[model samples]
Target chain A: MGDIEITELRKLTEFIKQEFDYDFKNYAMSSFRRRIQRVLDLYKMDSVDELIRLLAKQEFFFEEFISEVTVNVTEMFRDPTFWRVLREHIIPNILLNHNKISIWHAGCSSGEEIISMMIMLDEMGVADKAKIVATDVDKAIIERAKKATYPLKNMEVNRKNYLRYQGKYTLERYYKESGSEAIINPSLLENVSYRKHDLVQGSVFSKFDLVLCRNVMIYFNQTLQNDVLHKLHESLFKYGYLVIGSKESLIWCDIAHKFIVVNNEEKIYKKIKD
Target chain B: MPKFELSTKYKAIVIGGSAGSFQPITQILAALPKEFPVPLFLCLHRLKHVRHGFVEALSIKSNKDVIEPADKESIRKDKVYLAPANYHMALELGHFISLSTEELINNSRPSIDITFESAAYAYRDKVIGILLSGANKDGAAGMEAIHAKNGMTIVQDPSKSVINAMPNAALARTKVDYILSVEEIIEFLLELDKKYRI
Candidate 1:
């Protein structure tokens, strides 16, 4: 909340960067401050010196802090209309290009959005041919995603969302509800794989038919956004589709010109010919 | 825990939105008649640090009396109450508004869940809950609570919503009565009002 606090935070950033090699140097100031404040609050430290001492000796706080700082609020079918656009405009395009399709739900949080994609693919009768490599920055959320159990209370909404996306079956049939939770059908993951990935570090995989990275870039600075955009551009196949959060844009990104807008208002784009 | 069929009775409406919700709210408000009789509430989401002058902006677009809800102000028909920043706006009794600077519920101050839940509690079977667009599952449980109280529940078809997360989240949680587009939602509410008036 003051200059002294900021100076201490800079020191903390350097310590984390040098020791852990997980960069938080360019994240949005609010996220940076919030995470730092939370760390200080958790340890009941009045000053950054005590916090730095704890970090220097204790190893677990680094991993815990990273998870706490970076974990975003997300859910399945995150943006219903975005998926609608994918179903209507993007999927047909992908189907036309190749029967075997590979898509990436990069920066997937808790895997809800990725599962939404799987349900969509299943409904479209392309589940067998489509393979999705779901990736995220947090290994913990990725682990939760692999399990695929959701609150049973949310099943009703999930079912309605599925129907809104033109899914034909009763959502109840997809999974059996036990007490307060519903286990997603394992068939949904038949061609899906989960991995840990950081967009800033670039991707090892390439040539995806559709790449969806929503809402995760808002926390990054402009430079990081462009850096992430370049990674996404490289990962996309020729004429592949790219979707981002509605508020996020590639306007200032270095690779903005490489992708032309498909539904610009919806934040969906298509990789233009190089 | 008594279950009863919910329907709109008091003719007061409160709407909240943020992020990709501007279009849906504008479209819905524009569709209402110039002499609409119901009081409306709105909570437009933004960073908690600043107050959005939503009342003036919405008033400029419609003939309705859009104004911020003063502390402990009684609700009035044809007037709209937009929740101020840094507070949770609630329906006190059936015809009044209350604000509290409570800690964030569901990561928001003027949260959709808080408003809808309070409205459902205060108005009971007279309330109608409609969720439009948002990025989190904030309104889903609140909408379910409204429906459980026998209140009429409607959700924007996620396929048609600008940001489908909020609406789609609500749709996933309850046996919602109506799934409509933004345009259809306006028309549907008006028709309900007309039908219930007699």
Candidate 2:
């Protein structure tokens, strides 16, 4: 926790950025320090230079380290009220304006949430009309999401949350239990695709009707948040919905004005037409 | 069909803290009924990136529902939504909980302020926002917003709080409607449920 450590870590991070083409330039200082300390602890190396030297030799080490640092904390039906807002407000808007919808569940940690979205659409009778592009920075989570199984301990809340989202049928019906894991219904993922996407790089595609980039922006600094929001703004269709984590606000982002708050409380935004 | 009506269906209790919040929170929650109809949202900030079974542990301490909030899930009447570590928990309209990793206010995700502020905005007069013992000013602005929205607000009396900075800071910012011990907060909630039920 010293200035010397901070300086060394910054230099090392910059070195990685230049050589690896992966940017750690914009993460918060505290988080960066914590991750560096963990890396040091993991390798039993005393200095940042040593860790960086090892990382230079092992390319896979860098990938694994990034995954360790950026692993997300998420669950199915995360913000019940946010989902309700989507269902009551955003879903209707999508149904009315967009004939077909493509949603990007950006930073979809383990795909449970993307499955949740599909379930909601199924309940709304719009499952066939929607296609989701689920992306995450971590390969492990993507693999897990692809498998679509979660501990049964988490089911009660997930089911309760489904009810709270106002699903008409029992949430229990969607999944079959395999040992302790609840294997998600394959039908829910029929129209979805999962890939690796880092928000810092910005996205190549556009014209998405809804882009759900929740809880992922907190990893970035304000400048990065703005950058990511701008990317989201450009990618969304006119009148498309942009949903962020509940605590996130576009007020400070550079493109804040481009979207109107659909439900300010839920942090739901609707892209305003030019 | 005299439907449940006091203000809105989003009626519920929300509790928040940073450090040293787990026990007081469990104590307060354990006193509630098995079928407590109001949803309970808890924002207990802990060590970063650690999911240490806080919800499982606390659920054992209380009969009412408890679990981590999932993306796009709905808020239930009696369940407790514990902020997953490293994320901010907020109330979206229509009683769903939204989790975020947005810029950390007061340097914490699952921030007490963000959770209380969003609940206040969505639930208005129907919310009961409580700030428990902690080490920072995270929940102060949020509790203030809740009060301004005509929601009921409560804080553990700092004198009795294990970590007094959070409750003390909240009391300094807003005229909290109740400044009680953890036990009293539970009593107040139970009383309100009975008095206001349709």
lDDT of each: 0.72, 0.77
Q: Which stretches of candidate 2 lie over 4 Å from their true place?
A: A1-4, A39-46, B1-198
Q: What is the TM-score of each candidate against the true structure?
A: 0.60, 0.61
- Candidate 1: which docking quality band? incorrect
Best by lDDT: 2
lDDT of 1 by residue, B56-161 (tens): 6677777677776643456787676777665567775536665544346778877887688767766766677777778888878778878887777878788887
All models, DockQ values? 0.03, 0.08
Q: Per-residue lDDT tens digits of candidate 2, residues B81-138? A: 8888767677765567655554466978778877887777677777888889899999
User: How large is the interface RMSD of each prediction?
Assistant: 14.0, 9.7
lDDT of 1 at A226: 75
- Candidate 1 residue-wise lDDT, A1-274, digit = tens: 2212456767877887898777777664434554566567776777777877887899887666667677445556655666788877789788986888888988887777877888778888888888789988787878878888888876665666666665566767667777898888887787888888877665557668888887677666666777888888888887888888654567767778888999965688989965
Which candidate number has the best DockQ?
2
C-alpha positional error of residue B25 in candidate 1 after TM-score superposition, expressed in Å: 14
